[model samples]
Target: MSLRSRTAGAVLALAVPFALAAVPADAAPVPEADPFVWTDLTPTYTATADYQYEPFAVTDGYRPIGRCAQGTGTGEGGAGYHYVNPAHVGSLDPAEPAGLLYETDSNGGRALVGVEWIVRADNAAGAPTLFGQSFQGPANLDGVGSVYTLHAWIWKDNPSGLFAPWNPTVTCP
Candidate 1:
């Protein structure tokens, strides 16, 4: 074979085993809902639309299904927070966070977990929608008043349901 063809064949030979072995019978990482720990929990929120979350979070307690209501986690609760704006209503920006999901550590540090999509409810309209699904809010929020939201356990699996308001599987770190 020619030099170009020979070089290509060698490259493919080295890649074949990796391609075939990359997927082991059971090599998937633990579910996001499972107890995964992250390191940094930075604060980042900026509103770019009319729809938005209340600047101040209202209350902290068990949520719709007893799962900690995100930022409302108790003294020893996990610390999940929102950091987005109404302009993000239908944003497709992968890095434009809808919200920051966190699990607080023993030292009181917050570990990043999943992300949430948040939007506001206009007096004249219904909830916002994205990713082929409607945003979750339109329900009354404690700090920012009433709004819509979506929980993408993209980083974790929620036993409470992938899109459930609160993740039943998330635990304090």
Candidate 2:
């Protein structure tokens, strides 16, 4: 065979096995369902952050099922917090990055969507601590299995006061 053809054949031979090895047979990663895409979750409110009792409402001891990526544990509690929004939300402490929580409901009349966010801030004692709240709203899906936009009203609670942060809404394409 010619030199070019011989080199091409050798390259394919090496790549074929590696590509096949990447696909696991039994232990394949399971993709977590996207409530936004699945139409199973409500979609009326995009995402917002406010002190009111709307979506992002502040309540204690409530968590949702989420995933950072495949092959990772479920983010039901605070255990699987490694899953990040690639897009950094604000200039918060790296060690205590902000959290983005999600909840959804499918019923039409009852709006079932809530988002919880946690950031480093001062508690009532005036000490550096973590505070978070849930912004909830009605889930209005545009269409079944259709793409829609998600928005959140995010802010910073520091000594200066509450400030609207960057990239508050998360759009689902």
Give the number of the best model, judged by TM-score.
1
Report the number of clashing residue pairs per model.
13, 19
Looking at model 2, residue 58 earns an lDDT score of 26
Model 2, TM vs. native: 0.18
TM-scores for every candidate against the unseen true structure: 0.47, 0.18
Candidate 1 similarity to native, TM-score:
0.47
**CA lDDT of each prediction against the hidden true structure:** 0.44, 0.25
Q: Compose the digit string of candidate 2's lDDT tens values, residues 5-121.
A: 454455445433443343356643422122222121112121221211223322321222244212122321211111123233222332222234332223422121222233222
lDDT of 2 at 66: 40
For model 1, residues 79-127, the per-residue Cα lDDT tens digits are 2544433344444344354454555545665444456665656656676
The C-alpha stretches of model 1 lying farther than 4 A from their native spots are 1-79, 83-94
For candidate 1, the lDDT comes to 0.44
